[model samples]
Target: MYSQLWCRTGLLGLLWLISAGFMSAQTPARTELTVTAMHPAADSPLRLGANFSLRIHYDSPAAFRLRIQGERQGTTIPGITHASPRYGPGAGEAIAWLAFDHLAQLDRILLVAEDAATGHVLTSLALPLTLTWSADAPPGAPAPVWVQELNQHAQLAITREMQAPADGGDDFWVNLFLQAVFLTVPGYIILQIALPWWTRDRWRKAAWAPLIVTVPMFLFVVFASTAGGSNLAPIWLLLVCPPACFYLVFLALFFWLKQKRA
Candidate 1:
């Protein structure tokens, strides 16, 4: 009986050791990755036609692969080379170079890391970027001929006509003529027909009131024809049409009431 008890105890001890080993094998290791630094920092603007280098420092428990992606104005920016996988328990870094060759309204970059073995994403970071023309660049200076040629194949092309010098001589005279006609013709018709009919008894005296109002209207028409024509033409009409319509309605109502009383 004593020999049997000793045998049973040894067998139980062996099973417990095996069970502990299996549990240890099944539990996943807790791996951590932390970003320590980024060169150029965040939200930095770069000059157009300039080359820049970027670096990212990180601490991780195991080896990982990094991917760099860039976008501008909702289009992908090309010419980014991704770095190879780096192994580290303490510190590691990745580097990349970029060239800004095209114009962009808004730019952004993304850094992503994945576990080398499992292909699981370990970390990600996004940075805002901007590309702007150099402030010291001379005005009206043409871009390099190569840059102009490249622009033709670019997703956001910049045409030579867009960069051409502004010629406002013909446009200015045409706008002025249209404005004068709009102002004078309308007032003349109203004074000759509408005013005489509406105020037949005191037509001579009341004519000056409409003419006085015409001065400001003429000024507004001039502004709309000149300044508004470039970009604000539709918006100018939206603003001006409502008030002009309301004024006409009021005048018609006033004439109706006067006729009713008479």
Candidate 2:
């Protein structure tokens, strides 16, 4: 009798396992997106027309859309929004921004991520927040240059969101090309100083080489003396390159014209 009961129990357990496996195999996988952190402490007050960045990590099916919205004591704030025209991510790292035009006792901020193709919201993350006007600052304080630029950029993002084409007016390739030019143009210009050496006969005096090289060396000295000293971006970083690498292209045609005239 005891053996019979034990066999029945084993048979019932095996059947249940088979049914559970069948159900799980038929179910689809779920999507996941998780926010790890945000900037500025709760006590830190945000300024009007300022921008803030959020650090995010997500596992999205495809490239996702991000937007920012705000609330005060659970009440939705109007005329304020955020967008990502270039920085939107398809997978892995993500980004968001905040922009506002007026002061309010903001109790929280909401972040919404969506499927760019279908407009389906992937996830929404909300955090308690506070915004205020500076007590020490005078009324109607003028924004700093950086702040003004950031706000203008945010406004541009908004306009693009409304007016941009289905292709999203993405400029990733263009930006990549420009950045490559900035980094490599200097190297190419320095190569030009060696042209006379390569073209002249062995016995001929390439008199132009020494003088032309001296100017770039002097410019390098000036740049090295002041490299990484400023908080803002500089025209030429302190390096072993001529300052003309950037504007040298503008003078290319004139050099050709002079050669033609000669």
Q: Which candidate has the top score in TM-score? A: 2
- What TM-score, computed on C-alpha atoms, does each candidate reach? 0.32, 0.42
Q: What tens digits encode model 1's per-residue C-alpha lDDT throughout 1-262?
A: 9999999999999999999999999875544434444433344454565434455566776667666667776676674343344444457444544554555434776666777766667777766766443444333333344333322333122233233323556766876765754554544545445654566555435543454555565577678768765333333343343444445446666766888998
Local lDDT at 251 for model 2 = 43
Instruction: State in Å the error of residue 174, model 2.
Output: 25
What candidate 1 gets wrong by more than 4 Å, as runs, is: 1-49, 73-75, 104-106, 117-120, 131-262
| Candidate 2 clashes between residue pairs 3 or more apart in a chain or in different chains | 63-90
Error of 1 at 143 (Å): 25
Worst 10 residues of 2 by lDDT: 231-240
What's the lDDT for all of these models? 0.54, 0.56
